[model samples]
Target: GHEHSLTGHKQRGTVLLRKMEISVAEADKRTGKNTVNMQETYTVYLIETRPAESVPEGGTPAAPDTLWRRYSEFELLRTYLLVTYPYIIIPPLPEKRAEFVWHKLSADNLDPDFVERRRVGLENFLLRVASHPVLSNDKIVFLFLTEVMNNLEYFIFFPETQIIALKIQTRFISAVFSRRFMGLKHYSDELNTIILQLLRVRARVADRVYGVYKVHGNYGRVFSEWSAIEKEMGDGLQSAGHHMDTYAAAIDDILEEEEHYADQLKEYLFYTDSVRSVCRKHELIQYELEMAAQDLTYKKQQKEELATGAVRIFSLKGMTSKLFGQESQEQREGRIAALEQSIQEGEEAIKEKDAECQEFVQKAWTDIERFKEQKDKDLREALISYAIMQISMCKKGIQVWSNAKECFNKM
Candidate 1:
């Protein structure tokens, strides 16, 4: 049990050193290099401030008869230093009461370098506060003074100062104010102020330490709340980074799809242009076919008119020959021979025109039929190509949609 108690005390001492606002070298110097073994001999130098009030058997508060007196400034300062100073320092000064007066003097407009001077002066002061043997030990007053000093420490950079002011404020508030909701009739406003001020000081101190270390390249510990805040900011940034990545991918996909669509559109335009050119040529062919048909009909009409004129001339020739009355056999034979030759030549002329007209009609119809067949074939091919293009476009659209859905799910 003694060994365990010694181990616990060593652990506490180590922890206290670790918590100080000092360098490792400074902590080592303050605590010394002595090994904290269970069997080690150590001397305790504490000066008891006061005796604790005796409580009843049931742990009840003492009656009004057990009166407790208040403390004087010198005695209070001495007691307060022993208690509150440890909260700030590592392996705190054994007798720090004399240092409190120096801190108070420094706060009252002493030289800026007084803090260094006080550090030196304290070496002698601790011995005096410790060796003094006439001081009363009032534990209650000391405990109250410790709390008062801690509260005052927010506004005053000192080991201990006018801590009684804070206690007076607390007493004043408690005496006049009562909170029914909290069931707190004696709660101190001065204590609340200390808590609020401490929180504010913690934040300010953290910022100062961080700023100084960053600028001068020095040392300090991180505030407890800083890690939590930094973690939250990191999470937010990671989330934003993911969103940006998804957006970039979507943009890339859209650009690729647009390029593909542009390619398909270019192909479709080429095919449409080709079909339009073919259709233009087919239209020209149809026009030529109509003109050929008109030319053939005109030629047929001219042939009919020529055949009618030949028949009229033949009739006139026969009438004239009859009216003239040929008496000699030689003259009549020559006239008959000439008339037969003219009639043969007229029939040959008619046959030749009819053949030529038939040829024109056949050629015109053949050309028109060939043009119509070629045009129909071209139109069928164009329709088939257009249908195929539409099917391909639909399939591409479906593929793009599926790809987009997949990308979205991955996101």
Candidate 2:
């Protein structure tokens, strides 16, 4: 019944932020002594979760469950997801601190604009996790959305046995998909590099655009001042100044919207790391498999030496035997028996590892395909939305200046 309920919720659950509040709290500076040496201001977002099933017609709607979560709590949740699902590209949290910031923009994390953007980013991260077929059904994730826990400490406290089991499972899976995994790694790395370059160029362009918009504000002030000195043309000059001011004010909203698009790009940039993580896991598995195979071969060689009574050239075991005098027939037979047992066990281990590797490759590749499809769809929509926004911004600029031209004609 619990599994059925969880499945139903996973199929239709929705997560959203209703609002955020900023508050100051005393924090220990960790300077050896236990004392609150700093007052830190942080945001607390109000998360709201609606029922999975729709309300019946003419029936009272179910009240959504609500809880407050700090940004640090979000970080904790994301970290757990990253650890638990190394193969899935866990959605990235918003930047904890702004980077590549424009000189004109405030870099303070507490700044209202920055906090608001983070709020949106946090909501998007939760929605992404909630919508994932596999991630959505996670017990911890479900609890996170619906439970009113004060802290997420329990979520991170997995049993040692479970962790070991997970590590072993991942290790086995990674061993068989070397070539394809390497290809995925290379592609992700290249894409990450290109996105970083694009973001850098965008920041520089935004700085210039900011300056250009401020120049229009200056032009507006000049026109308004000139209007004060004019006779018949004064009203027209004042009207033009108002149009210029409106155009100048539009840039802030435009740039803020552009930053949203930039965040979308950064999501993929972070995704590359997750992709490389899978590649690294695969390499580790392959390395483990190779070592096991090599050990088995060495064991077989030992068995051969014991059976044939011949020592391979420059062998340390052979040299030790020669220095200490050869074993008696009984001792020799015991050594051969031990070697034979070890070789048998080694063969069985190799077979098990091979089977595990094959299973892992199949599961991993299937997940990778699903991830690729989601990535393509998301990227296509983001790019198209960005293009449309740019076109709309240009149209607005044209309309503003044209209105100013009409004001001049009226004069």
Candidate 3:
């Protein structure tokens, strides 16, 4: 998640943010301050934090912070962020992994090195979210950075039902959804590219298969005609050099040709069916891609008509300012933060969709390659059988002609 969003930033030299250090330690077992009683000692990571904005006294906000959080706390924070920002593509957390080792009971999952690695990963995850223009202003994220997360509760709590109505405004939702919808359309183009490629490959393979089928059909026709001739001449030769042995030998040659023609027909039919089956499977994927594209386009167009800005009365200092409804600096920053979040979320979503489309196409191509290999083997086997039968039939024809000549000499 972080990779897609930042890879471009790194390349463009747009990634310049202050770094935060993270360190982990065994939780103090002696501190009898467990709100939720635990059976065993756990670990926690200490995060470096800074104030959200300037202070009135021009001092750093809450220096020497108490921003220590455990793994479960991190999980809780992630869950809250997902619920709160359904429109944003939040960065992923490190997996809780259990690794095994032979002969020795592996405790690597709880090992210091392992915990340190996880801490670093978690810290980076937060940093990525913080660097995002919109996610940086998220209240949950602020708590993750500023306070010791002791209270296991909701990230954004509403005082009442009325507050809930005010917390997520209609305009805010419209802005987020609009950006997300546009992001989907932006990435759907890549899926379209993949579908086109698959079609081209299918077409090319069909052309070659059809060409082979035509040749094999003609060969089969020749064999059928020879078979008919042999059947008609079964027990007699109508010509002056007529002989019953010559008719029997012709039947043997026709039998050999039957094997050759059967093998050809088998290959032809197999390839034709294979082409249809492969195309049919991929066509379903194509349909899904097209539908996803259509859905994104429709959603984007619907929301694009809505206003993309947040508006609220922002006066907080003076009575006169409040009466005039003058915009406060904090309010302006909040609006800017909202806009920035939408833009960043949209970009992250686009990146995610692009990656998914690429992966899907890559898997399809891999499957196609495997299918081609299998079909190639089948084709090779068919050709080899035909070749072997043809050679045997040729030898039989030579021997039969020799006997026929002897018979003619005797006559």
Regions more than 4 Å wrong, model 1: 1-231, 310-411
Candidate 2 achieves a global lDDT of 0.72
Provide the overall lDDT of each model, using Cα atoms, as 2-decimal numbers.
Answer: 0.33, 0.72, 0.46
* Winner on TM-score (1 vs 2): 2
CA lDDT, candidate 3, residue 204: 53
Query: Which order, best to worst by TM-score?
Result: 2, 3, 1
Model 3, which residues run further than 4 Å from truth? 1-38, 51-66, 99-108, 154-411
TM-score of each: 0.21, 0.83, 0.32
Candidate 3 lDDT tens digits, 1-411: 111123322232212223332223223222334557755556666666543332447655455344567777777776566444433444556546522111122346666544644555565566556555456666566666666545757555534643343333322332212232344334434434543454345335434533443454444354445445665542222221233234333543343333233322332333333333223333333444555555555444333422332223332434555578766667756655665566556556556665655554465345445434543554465546556755764575566456546643543
Weakest lDDT window of 10 consecutive positions for candidate 3: 1-10
**TM-score of decoy 1:** 0.21
Candidate 1 weakest lDDT stretch, 10 residues: 20-29
lDDT of 1 at 13: 31
Error of 2 at 149 (Å): 3.5
Per-residue error for 349 in candidate 3, Å, reads 27
RMSD of each: 54.0, 6.6, 25.6
User: Which residue pairs collide in model 2, if any?
Assistant: none
- Candidate 1 local accuracy as lDDT? 0.33
